[model samples]
Target: MAFDSQWGLSATGFYVPSYEEVLDSIQDDFIARFGSDIVLTSNSNFGIITRMMARREKASWEEQQLTYYSAFISTAIGTSLDYIGGNLGLKRKVDEPAFATITIATEGEYLIQAGEQFATESGYVFTLLKDVVTTQNNDGSWSGMGMVQCEETGADTNVPINSITTEVDPDENILSVTNFEKAGGGQDYEDDETYRERLRMENEARPGSTAAGIRSALMNLPGVREVNIVQNPSNATDKYGNPPYSVHIYCLGGDKGSIAETIADYIAAGITLVGSQQLKVKDATGNKLDINFDFATNKPVFAKVVINTDDAWNVDNGAEDVKQSIADYINELEMGDPVYITRLYPAIYDIEGVTDASIAIGTSTTTLQEKNMIQTDFEAVTCDPDDIEVVVNGL
Candidate 1:
């Protein structure tokens, strides 16, 4: 590492001389080489060239510092961060399609084949994952539950509950189809900071059957965003009805087969797993084992915003801007975090010309509140621009 008037690689790290210092050094060198009597005013050709050189030098040093920082985990970004994660055997999570549980009805018993396509009013399509045979309910209506995935990916497709009412291409036997809950698990490609954090977690995680180790391994799986483990150590069944010496794992995203396989590999032999969804997987010895875990749900959050704005507001886009900002805040919240009414204020005030604002939050539009809405750990809160209603200038 050599120290220089412009820049240096030293003991602490990369360093660069300040603009003023660099300018003075260059001026001194000019005087030494030529003479002090030379004119170097701001208007002079020599002065302009000197300043330009100084600026270019500082910019080059700053770029070098960034390049140096990219080699380490904490300071790395973008593709550099992806490379570090890759070295740890972790690939960044990519975009995922939104999933929905839809109920289909028919006038008579009918086999709703896999690949049946349904849609929302906006024309977003969802394809059924498996075949379902409709049955008569106690009410005498024929219906069955079908799991669907959006034809396209990303969070934009997480439509509201009951919004998937249309059948794409039309089905003669199917009388109606609708989603009971909001579609969820639709996520954009993982961002740099999030990918970097996962890389750090994977680096520190050790290989074992312990809870921490199992969680870390599962988190490394693509499409998996959140994980939770509940252990029942006593001889009696727990409150969630887990048998003695059993474990319950709840995950928000990831492929079912991969999730089961990861659990089978990390969990100790003979530990009973409990969940609604179950699959069989082979362990290290080629012994088949049952792995169970539930897919967590996303609870829809509705918000209402009343704001007073000044003339600076662009009337055409002001309402839209507020809705998007608030929706982003709500959607980014972690699973089980409570939605505070006051927290919505900052998002609204961030919009230009919004002098004052008040907000309300609720699980449903009818039950909105001026305070916070509590959420259970099993569910994540989700919001979209359509879920947020905006009133501008008290109109």
Candidate 2:
């Protein structure tokens, strides 16, 4: 068969000729045209030329294959993905800084100005979101709460509670600084896999009161991590106490108002919205209607990792590195996704000196889990760096 005829779109799928196949086709043509008497060994100059020609032809076929795949979301990547996302009205999310509330105690009445930087021991810096003026308390000390945002983007800034203890530039009046709650909402730029998934969802999403459509719309919102909608489609109230034809939306990490508004826009009229949290959203006629949705609770996943390492391992930071890696993987999981102990192997092995590792995960520290930790649809697994304990066996 001709080289060109062997590769291209077939009934099965897009196909491309391998390097060896292309070379064989070229040699067969050469022998058919010039007769078998012609020298055709790798040592021969003609054979070398033939091999080079085959390589070039194979490269062209690969490029054509890439072009074909690039038109579809499933296989497209990088700039091609960006192009498809733009056409679908889906812009890739950029990295966002983490934000948390920090408590500032002062020896005397002091003003914690906006832009004052605080840092964790690991050196992640965060700036106060707004000015916080301290008020005198009964004991003559002053304290106030201030919201702060990490100066940098990414998950590393989502430090654990009490991690932000250092003041980047020490202020004499500000006696101490610490975060009682873990900083959250930090995210890396949406990767190709995630972006492609979103594109697929958006492409299939229709404009109507649909579970998939509502979930897709909510997922596109900034800070919205996961969304699950459970509908009681029966004529009577379901076991979950949802009224007839009611939907209970469980979402994690999105503005409550935005969630309410999006639910209002997508939900069909006369359908009862069910949840614990309620927010008033304006309807199309500018009338306010109460919308309800439950914020998915975080199922804190504690892990104990024992790693066998060699001399090549980074002794000082290796444990923390492993902890952070595990935390990152756990935090990235969507709502109700089980915490698979086996899935953490890749993240652990990615560390330079890790030879072997064993991981145990559970919802609480008291109970140990060998099997995957399952969660309800309204729960998302959360793992703080501090929650992950790493032990190096052979450091």
- Clash numbers, per candidate: 0, 0
Q: Where is the poorest 10-residue window by lDDT in model 1?
A: 1-10
Query: Candidate 2's residue-wise lDDT over 69-92, tens digit each?
Result: 998899998999898888888889
**Model 1, residue pairs in steric clash:** none
How accurate locally, in lDDT, is each candidate?
0.83, 0.85
For 68-129, candidate 1 gives per-residue lDDT tens digits of 88889999998888888777767887888888889999997999989989999998899999
lDDT score for residue 173 of model 1: 86
Clashes of 1: 0
Q: Provide the global lDDT of candidate 2 against the true structure.
A: 0.85
- Identify the candidate with maximal TM-score: 1
